[model samples]
Target: MGKDQDLLHAVKTEDLLTAQRLLQRPRPGKTKLLGTAKRVNVNFQDTDGLSPLHHAALSGNKELISLLLEAQATVDIKDQNGDSSTAL
Candidate 1:
């Protein structure tokens, strides 16, 4: 699956480990931590217009939500119903 699909799957299944892995990126030989993470498109919207942050919100996983936010996941990306993850 694509990174987007993987992110969504990780969110839906409440897989924090996988979600963290998705948000991370190796900088040549080093790695980017949450404080500096922004490699992946954590704001990417799915077919239904729900981003990974949106899914994380719905799932009520604080750790996942934190990770997404640190990765720069936009909180204002509206879904099909015109509601963002922050609304949850």
Candidate 2:
């Protein structure tokens, strides 16, 4: 699978380490890591239109939720069923 697909899978399964690695870009050895330049889109939705935030929220994973939020996942994006992450 591609990086985007792997990222989505990591998020869906609540695999924090994999998700973090996918979201973080490796910097120059001495360069300080900055915010989200190479991070995956946290709001990417599946075929059903369910985003990572929606899955995280439904699974009650506060850590994953926070991570996705920090990555700028849109909480207001609705799924195929018209349910937003906040409403999940």
Candidate 3:
């Protein structure tokens, strides 16, 4: 599979340790880690500009969401459709 897909999979699987390692590594072949899309950082968006915190709110993954929020992710980050994080 493509490298980006692999990385995205790691994030979705909640393998935060591995995802952190991959993000810290220099991109292979000039690829960027964060992507041009901000939501890509934590796989937070679901066809919107919502952050992972938003998902946590909906799914009640409080611990994981707390970690993301603590990491300085933009709490008010808006998506392409103007959806911002209303997650608590």
Candidate 4:
């Protein structure tokens, strides 16, 4: 429940394109409107203490894992149980 929560949702729902698009920041006519979605923080954790990278790893999405890594998602971030995405 935060500004960039959609980023987490996109990862959770397996919506790769939407996740990719949301990662893009809107520029001067070079991208689509993402509203607040454009300001998403790649490393932001949800209430469950799970970050997008965590979900991607849990879902076994290699493509999403690459995207998240490219976006600088912190791999060592722990979840509610102090588990990290080092599974990647």
Candidate 2 residue lDDT tens string, 8-80: 7887888999988877656667565585355567778889998888888888989888888887889999999
lDDT of 4 by residue, 41-86 (tens): 9998888899999999999999999999998888999988889999
Supply candidate 2's per-residue lDDT for 72.
Answer: 80
Worst 10 residues of 3 by lDDT: 36-45
lDDT of 3: 0.54
TM-score for candidate 3, please give it.
0.45
Please report, as a residue range, the 10-residue window in candidate 2 with the lowest summed lDDT. Answer: 30-39
Our model 4 lands, by Cα RMSD against the true structure, at: 3.2
What local lDDT does model 1 show for residue 28? 85
TM-score per candidate: 0.83, 0.80, 0.45, 0.80
Say which prediction, candidate 3 or candidate 4, comes out ahead on TM-score.
4
Highest TM-score against the true fold, candidate? 1
Per-residue lDDT tens digits for candidate 1, residues 3-64, read 77888889989999998888776658676567654456788888899999899889898999
Q: Flag clash pairs in model 3.
A: 49-79
Off by over 4 Å in 4: 1-3, 28-38
- Lowest-scoring 10 consecutive residues by lDDT in candidate 4? 29-38
lDDT of each: 0.86, 0.81, 0.54, 0.85
Total residue pair clashes for candidate 1: 0
